[model samples]
Target: MATRLNPYISFAGTARQAMEFYKDVFGGTLNMSTFGDMGAPVDADGIMHAMLETDSGYTIMGADTPPGMEHRAGTDMAVSLSGDDAVQLREYWDKLSASGSVQVPLEQQMWGDTFGSCTDRFGVTWMVNITG
Candidate 1:
């Protein structure tokens, strides 16, 4: 199998919801495992790990901050999505910006591309760039 590099996000306690929201945005199959499933004494429903694999071959994995772990928001990390497909990328921007804070509106950039940045409702930062 070929090696792949994907983002692994960490959530405070909303990994399940965040992963589900991503599934809606990217149209993918999500497989999740919880602490209880792993025989951990943490919250039964707290996600231990979740992976979302989209049809576009995008893979995002995430997990909740396990017990005794501190979750700090805005730690200089952002998940970036970039492609030449304007329609798909715009759709993602719309969904991601809804109910979230937009740091940069999706529009033409000086570099001749459509770009935007936002923090999702779950506090995960995202950047979407669409090539012109």
Candidate 2:
């Protein structure tokens, strides 16, 4: 195994729904553990940890906010997807921006690449860049 860096999101009791939504968007295998699985005296159905590993080699991890933690809903960070695969990237962008707010429409950017940013329905910000 090698070292890796990925996003670990904290949701306000919506980790299950959000991770499921991401699985649909990225077409991945999702493995989730619940609070009850860890013997924690919380909502049995609440996700303690969830991981989505996509065919595109993307790994997304998340969980419901802990029993005594704050979950803020804003873009202090954004997950970036960049590659030369235009079709796949566009497909991802379409699905991600659907039913969500688009901060920037997907189009050619000043940097000479196709770029866009949006907040998914789960309130997670994503930046997609298609390189030529």
Candidate 3:
């Protein structure tokens, strides 16, 4: 089987709620396991891991809040867009990031490609890396 990259999100004690919300939004089959199943006493009720495999061939993995961890919201993630079709992906970035904050404007960078970071209208941070 070919190797694939998937997004693994970390949540602060809300893995089940967050995964369920994602299942509602993306319409996917969610498989979850608890830490207790892994013989973790402190983390027994917490989600050890959860994965959402969507119908559109997207795989997203997430886990619940770790023991005694603090969540620094809005500072820890990036929804990345990476593909060969530079034009199409740029268009998507432009549309999704419009009316939002643009941290790094989309432009040719020193890496010999275009890259940018922006926060969407819904306050989600996104990173678009357009590779040649």
Q: Count the backbone clashes (under 3 Å) in each candidate.
A: 0, 0, 2
List of clashing residue pairs for candidate 2: none
lDDT, candidate 1, 6-45, per-residue tens: 8899888889989999999999899999999999986889
TM-score of each: 0.95, 0.96, 0.60
Candidate 2 — which residues are off by over 4 angstroms? none
Candidate 1, residue 12: how far the Cα is off, in Å = 1.0
Residue 92 CA error for candidate 2 (Å)? 0.4
> What's the TM for model 1?
0.95
lDDT, candidate 2, 73-123, per-residue tens: 645678999999999999999999998999999999988999999999889
lDDT of 3 at 51: 95
Determine which window of 10 residues in candidate 1 has minimal summed lDDT.
67-76
Model 3 / residue 1 / CA error / Å:
2.4
Candidate lDDT values, in order: 0.92, 0.91, 0.76
Ten residues in sequence with the least summed lDDT for candidate 2 = 67-76
What is the alpha-carbon lDDT for the whole of candidate 3?
0.76
Candidate 3 per-residue lDDT, tens place, 18-124, comes to 67865765577999999898898897878989999987677878887678887554477767777667876677677757767999998888988788898755445
